[model samples]
Target: MSTTPPRLTTASGIPVADHQNSLSAGRRGPLLLQDFHLIEKLQHFNRERIPERVVHAKGSGAYGSFTVTHDITRYTSAKLFAQVGQATETFVRFSTVGGERGSADTERDPRGFALRFYTEDGNWDLVGNNTPMFFIKDPIKFPDFVHTQKRDPQTNLKSAQMMWDFWSHAPESLHQVTMLFSDRGTPDGYRHMDGFGSHTYSLINAAGERVWVKWHLKTQQGIKNLMADEAARLAGTDPDHAQRDLFEAIARGDFPRWNVYIQVMTEAQADTWEQRTGWNPFDLTKVWPHADCPRIPVGVVTLNRNPDNYHAEVEQAAFSPANLVPGMGYSPDKMLQGRLFAYHDAQLYRVGTNHQHLPVNRARCPFHHQQRDGAMAIANGGAAPNYETVNAAGTAPSGFGHGDPGWALHGVAGRYDERGESDDFTQAGNLFRLMPPDAQDRLTTNIAHAMQHVSDDVQQLQIGHFTKADPAYGAAVRRKLADLREG
Candidate 1:
């Protein structure tokens, strides 16, 4: 029997005989830069890390499939929802929004629930959170809000003062702040909580009719949370508790799953929803009540496979709301629009110019584009034609639609003040009232304890916003704090 000799080659395809020894002036002399192999290896290692995410720095992911359980093909022409039993490959990542890679898994913070669907059309990424609503609606306030959640520059520590200061100034945060302080903020693990597509998106049917929509993923394991005290204890005992829970549970053949559902609104209804609710339909800080827009079950997503390499499959796995399929489109939600640009730009910086070429982020379907070559080019597009004729038909289906519907815009381009124009308090106030009595009590007590270290000036200012949301809300929180001071 004959076998081919083992081959060794450099990145440029040059055959190499010795990779261990580098060329030097002598056996004991200084090495030479002309040693292309050594220089290349060292240079690549020097640039190994791009940059950790400004948010969602720590995360875990799993391989899964989405099986459509119910179909509403009339609502969306998206291939993923085209049939009642269609199954699509998926990847879901759960993360702590403000924590570093080594932060405690039990941190009382909103969790990131990012889903990537490898549909026949392309990858449709529904990058969302475990909560249905967010802290702020406007994209401009995001950087400032996150800054307060992160460590203080001077002290290099997480500062309650910074967090409270920002919340007091931004009244829109009351709803999310209330949610964060409650039991739900400290989720038991990644498997026991629901997820939300927080931003409103558009669905275009085959006929080109557009409707606003939101997605939800209800966990099959049922909702479970750690109380404030339990969370604190777990934080000290096991920082990787959630990560281990997900991996171990999957390894035991007990796959975690979620029931996918969507709430949709017709264009005509969207026109009047703002007036009806006193909140913008596209606002990220609010949610369309299920009573008004009942959830229509669409599918079930089951995570059956755990990642073999966390760094390659999870750390470098990029998901973006901008990754929309043909029949799906974007709404005018400012935060979602800002993210469409930010997420891809962030991936390019954090991973590489050709980050999409990675096996995890790459498209499943044969995708053709003019993009090619960068720091890690896959052979620089080989000998393919770099230029094509001016026309290759339209980018959309035959006579269906080309892009997102062109809605009319008439506002003057200026920094328009939204204080009087927008109703930020009503929704948050209603959320407080809707909570059960016991939950409301826990929420206030949690706030009081967390604010014990906060300054009076900031505390007073913050409570004032809660007061506007509900007098009872403000009074309960104030009473708790007063007792703490007296004791």
Candidate 2:
């Protein structure tokens, strides 16, 4: 066969004879108006960039394989975990949840560990944070919570007062606040920390049994966190340390991996819990107690290849808890329900409405949906009718298939307030009590360092919350902070 190259083509694959010479009057004159190909190329290039994510703005991604090492079919009907040794293609992105696009990776904040597993059945995304719980449980309070974490517009600086004010008023945030002030707040890097599906999910088995579940992706490298001083130093010296570390690790063939495990609870068991007795399981702020349902290891995920293009692969990647396959499903978790709408809404704003068409996020298997005609829509329904159950050609019939386990809802139609619960500080106190002396010392020092920057009233308010969690723990932090104030 001849070894010559094929004809050049436009992005749409239309053959182009001479791209070197623009359509012109006489060979050296002004360009003609008939340069459609040139115009299309330049226009597309000019609009290639979309807005970055508001949160998790700065991130890095890699391609990976998820291999099932243990059978979990009893828990989920998802084919990806149906059999031992089964493998699925996955794309994972690691990010800092609160910081801007240029924020330091080692900052004392939660990390986002979002993974998309493209299986034969469909796409399943586990969008979570390194910490198991959050600062607030109610979806209505989410925007307020985030606003506090962001910078103060008047000062154009991050406001610790804003953060503490929000946390102090929302007593339920104590558990997560305690975790955030601990060493775990400043993880050594993305690879050395554990990730948790903070929101509870529901998994249905082949037998149609439903169980509430929480996913944990334990870093195989083991948990490592930086001391407050060390983290501050690194943040100043190497702001992109975590992002660079992940990129360098994959490039050097030193792949990073995590062991996937899950803690599951039954509906009957959930009926007794104070929070879930009448609450939704999808709430993102509360975490299921591990003692009630211990974690069971299910599989291993190894990220082996870095994205060749950061903007194309990593920046364009979109993940949402709503991207569930057949076997895995959602719960009434209010926060989760809010995210179901929020994540996709954010994606539409940041990456255009047709972001799913991006190669990094497209399903591996063929996909069919009623979605049609949006900007950046690369794969137009392609001759297929956009409506279902239509007499038009290429229209497929629409009907409901399998649904979640049948459960009766006997509540009224009007909005109601959540029932009062006992102290939210108990679990946080337990976490503090469990920490070793050295870790506790580090936690106190870190809290003091952060609190010292805020007003004395805000500091007092935060210490009051801490004291409620554990007297001794609060006393230590107070003592350390008072010493700092005096000195």
Candidate 3:
């Protein structure tokens, strides 16, 4: 048996004699133009990095398995949840939203919890966030909201004034704004925070009965958060603290897990609940209280394997809400409807036209499609017909069944404002009141600290929204702002 390592070769399989040096006139003269190896190396290196995600740029991903723990077939006939012990291969990406690729992990920002389950049917991506609610209910305001979270145009720095100014104008942002300032905003790490499919989705049963659902991944590690001071210190000292923690934990066999739960609501129940509470079930800014729609245990997701190549497995990985299998479907959530198009389009631009052909994003199950001939087309349908056709017998081939259970749409096709139509302040107030006195104090203090750089008008306007939520909540924030400013 040969016990020698193989000789290095160029990309074209040509043996390489000198890899450390380029072909030069002498020792350090001008390089020869015939040095294809040198040119290949430099060119590949220059184009190695793809465009970073517009949001959720800094992320860590891992492979794992999702084991069904309880029966939910009555709600959805998704093959992944067919039995109590079924285990489906999974990959999860934890990210910091609104941060650049090199941003600190401990920044006070909403975390992205995007999960992909490779089931027998296909890959199902549950693209979500650590928080159950978002800052805006409508997708039209999303770009505007995200712009505020990013660098200011003139100064090229994050501006609290811009954030507060936007929030003050959009009362729908109150609930998420409140959550962002709370300790939950700066979670200890990815393992200690909960993940929620913030948009209301739908689950269709074998009987074709559809139900509105909200997905939740409750961390088994329990919720642990960092105070603002500690978070800031860690951000400066160890910018990759969370990424290191996750990688090290999995390496040492201390795998992290989250118990999956889903809150179900029937169509009739959704209508009645919306009328009773004066809240739209499809509103991205609100949450369906557990009291009204109880959570049902479904499965357990454990991240036991870290990616071998960060760029190949993690960076190129793309998850879209549009990736749905049978028994799962979409809803009327405006934000979700917008994402259905935006997510895939972004990946098409960022990861290339055939991003799905990448190993990390590929479905485990066998799939056949007429789509072919794109850049980096790994399979390219392998000589299969690229278009559907009817045979000489005048019969079409069997195709994938429709997964989405259609719903009725009854509304004027025009821009309808939802400002005074929804009760955004009540939920924000309810969340504030739910916290203990100490937690409430910390929340108020955090809000005050974040608002320090904002203008007085924005602060007062935001305080008024808080007042509408709860008098004490508003009063506490106002008092803390005064004390912090005075000090």
Candidate 4:
């Protein structure tokens, strides 16, 4: 017998009939509700579109595996990294922030680097961005900052004035703003870019010792980016260029890879490292200089398989910082703390409440839960207890309780929004100074072109931040903008 799946059928398992035509009173007359097939098609079509993500809506994803090549059990005892030569299946979604699903691939926006690892224990989602820092360190300002990047309320169009207005007022945004308006901003495609977990997270070892860590996925493909003109040309001609590039690469067996590395700081080192470096270690708006904390090589992640279906795998794929397996823990960083909640809540709204059950997001390891029924409940916990009790004998020792490791904590809880104490300008200045002269010129030119549409006052205010980063940096941008205005 030829073993094959049956022919195409309706969603309710009924074979479709005359799919090309709609049931009507007569030809081109009012449709009849009794035609269940037509009614089902229209209803499903109407509800097909779920809400697009507020950020990182324009994205591409792939299936891959991460092989642990180094011993990192001293830093984190997470099962995926427990031993050298161990491999874990992973799903990665690369996205452009501040754009709709139909937006251009080459737009100068931060590329989101979200990774979901299907380890032996469970799933661990490390959702991050291309840059090592963010525009705002506090979650309270996130919504406001995103609003500036989004469409203007009245015009329903992107306004440079809105973007610069927020960045100019927020001096702490300088580091990320500088990075965003540079040559690296317009990466050639997803393959030629680096990925970073922007926030500092804690990792606990088998000994129960905790340390702060930062993840870096340096592209093995090496860095390649499009010039502004070329980016604009491609944006118009081939909006799905990056998506096509990644998909075609894996299809032809030319797999893309990234070298995963992590920088670790002990709890004792975290206490006074800021005093030594003249910067806060936990600040999401800044990066720890590699000289201060060098990255230790961990593993190599390669995307060897292209996803079978885009909508079923990529679009439904959800990632959250809260999805941590054992041997991983949280940190006191306010941004990290906020994301621990924000990411989960965002997924709940964007994907359904049972998003965790989706294949891409679901854990490969056996998992049981009291999380019963709701919309899209693939597994309804049939005949199982829905509540936790001693007699119920819940999912073993875990029992819906998280023993997420322990750390030393002693602090007075209060509103700590004051950013003046943190030195934000020095690092940005250092980055600018470190750039080659040609890179510097490109950076300034990029900034000027992007800022040309904004008001002069907004331009001047943003220039002040550039000026604060480096006198030469600010002067170059000013001159470039002047030349543009004259033309």
Top lDDT model: 3
Per-residue C-alpha lDDT of model 4 across residues 265-323, encoded as one tens digit per residue: 88788899878876678889989888878999999999988889888799888888988
lDDT of 3: 0.92
Assess each prediction's global lDDT (C-alpha) against the native: 0.88, 0.84, 0.92, 0.88
| lDDT of candidate 2 at residue 266, scale 0 to 100 | 87
Error of 4 at 253 (Å): 0.5
As for lDDT, the candidate ahead, 3 or 4, is 3
lDDT of 4: 0.88
lDDT of 1 by residue, 31-141 (tens): 998999888888988976657789999898999999999978888888889888889999999999998888999999999999999999899999999999998877888
After superposition, candidate 4 runs with Cα above 4 Å error: 1-6, 26-29, 390-405
TM-score, cand. 2: 0.88
lDDT of 1 at 435: 88
TM-score of 1: 0.91
Candidate 4 clashes between residue pairs 3 or more apart in a chain or in different chains: none
TM-score leader: 3
- Candidate 2 structure quality by residue, lDDT tens digits, 17-114: 78777888997899877898878878989988777677888888899999999988988888899899999999999999889888998888989999
Cα-based TM-score, every candidate: 0.91, 0.88, 0.96, 0.95
The candidates, ranked best first by lDDT, are 3, 1, 4, 2
Per-residue lDDT of candidate 3, residues 1-487 (tens digit): 9999999998889999899888999997999999998998999999999999999999999999999999999988888888999999999999999999999999999999999999899999999999999998888888998999999999999999999999999999999988998889899989999999989999988888889999999999999999989999999999999999999999999999999999999999987877799899999999999998899999999999999999999999999999998899999999999999999999999999889989999999898887788798886987677998857786443222454548877878999897888898999999998999988889999999889878999999999999999999999999989998899
lDDT of 1 at 36: 90
CA deviation > 4 Å runs, candidate 2:
1-49, 275-283, 390-403, 413-422
